[model samples]
Target: MDPPLSFTVPQEDFLLFHQVDRDLYKILVTELSRDPSESMRLLAMWLWLEKVGFHNVVKNIMSLPIILINEIADETMLCLTCLTNNSNTSLTTIMLSSEANDIPLLQSVMENEISLKFFRQNCMEAIHGVEKTRKEVCMRAFGDIMQRAMMRNIAERMVENNNFLFGSTGPINLQFGSVGIAGALGQQHSNNNGGRGGIIPADERTLFVTFSKGYRVEEWEVREFFTMAYGDCIETLFMQETQPNEQPLFGRIIFHKVSTIDMILKGASKVKFSINRKHVWVRKFVPKRTNTDKVILPGETSGFGFGITS
Candidate 1:
């Protein structure tokens, strides 16, 4: 193993396409391995890059050495290719002009968790195969990546918690709980049932279900509806409607097991339950991107073989 670089790394073009950059790869492995939340770190770093639009900043190489580097072989552009061979996403962009509102990155790529995870895993693997380092900045950058990642995780969790509606009136949503009972009703129901017996609460055990083109769905029927159609695959602990007692079509459900939702959906985004000649859909809620036509680059729909759904 080469000794860690004590001083600043020179602005040398090391990341070249069709070539392995050993030092950079090692840095990715050591830092990512040392940190338990490596996945989050990778996610946060990429999200930040996406927010700022990486291609725009790469014109100034040192601007984002962690992502795009102005390395030797490609003098005209910075290197953004994934280190590992599996990734189809090219880190760099073609004809990247400084002035542009559009990110040009495939929205589908960003939205699909699997694609992003695969890309990050590839980068880490190529990095794992590497031996050691040649730059102080690279080490510092790695630390920064973890810091931002951890912070992002904290922020995401904090935001999802039901603190905001603690003292105020709010609509019941997946973030809240099961059945049309939101604040006081849910507690009352649990008390009436002698507490949530044999029920477990986990973040992974929650699923957002929506009913479309169906009769006004009632919160009371959610459990039975899923049970009859899905064959009681798992015990449903509770349900809370997004709109309480207004015949709301969507709600959040709590299952006894974390895998219950997946087992029911069977890899599909939605399950169309035929109820009274109506269509009821339950899916993993993916927030819709507004003004998608402007954000997603044109003529870039070819790389969406990863089953990315809206």
Candidate 2:
């Protein structure tokens, strides 16, 4: 089949939104492929919707919000249709250079698995419509995508730290604990450990806590339950916020004395608690150290396993 060119969005935009796009693409490939799960169709669409919304905002196109949503939503449906029917239509070809291949993101995916390909009579078909309810759905979808990308908190902080960004109150979190602090210090978890502690250091007194695989235990439930066993020895209790329904997220319990951790660990990596029909666990808290803040030197790879050929 003769390859057709698609220029609905600029080529550079794909590389610009690479992380979110790539993530969305991976999900789409799985969901839109043969044997697609009818159960997961809604989830796949939400992920796709958020990706498109993020692009709309960053590019400052500000088209009617509904337009972008319908455009992307349609593309999603079209791709699903293409895969399901298994039509004999020639697989879409994107030349990187041909005048070459197609859009970088689309072209790159086609280079991978065969069943994940999509065909559009024209690229513009994928983008050009809006529904009556526009901005609200758009915002929620985009915000959720940011959460999936783990960039929502940083965006929230950027909003709060700047007077230019806030409206009357601040943006409301969609998730229950979306904006709530899952981790904080002492009687009032209003503060963090405040960098590394000076004297004993936070880790010496902190015990890492993990729950069972089935349920998501809340931060408060963890604190109240553990306080019974460890007593007032608890200095602070904190848990990381993640999916409220799926994998059990972990937490930290800092005791007043270092000996508490010794008693809990007892020369093992972790200690378990089976109380009130739920199993909880405790270990030593070791803060993750990352150089993500540091800039890559001129010749360094970006850690994507590929060198900067540029």
Q: Model 1: which residue pairs collide? A: 13-71, 13-72, 80-91, 178-239, 178-240, 179-239, 179-240, 179-241
lDDT of 2 by residue, 1-310 (tens): 3122223445456345444433343232232221122213423433333344422322221111221222233334445454344443433332111311122212211222211332343233222211211222222233334344345335545654553345423333211122232222211221232233333444457775555534556666776675676666666565543443544335556666676677667897656676566666666754321122222221222221212111
lDDT of 1: 0.36
Index of the highest-TM-score prediction: 2
**Candidate 2, which segments miss by more than 4 Å at Cα?**
1-198, 242-248, 292-310
Q: Relative to the unseen true structure, what is the C-alpha lDDT of residue 150 in candidate 1, on a scale of 0 to 100? A: 59
Clashes of 1: 8
In Å, residue 170's CA in model 1 sits off its true spot by 27
- Candidate 2 versus truth, CA RMSD in Å, comes to 19.9
Error of 1 at 243 (Å): 8.6
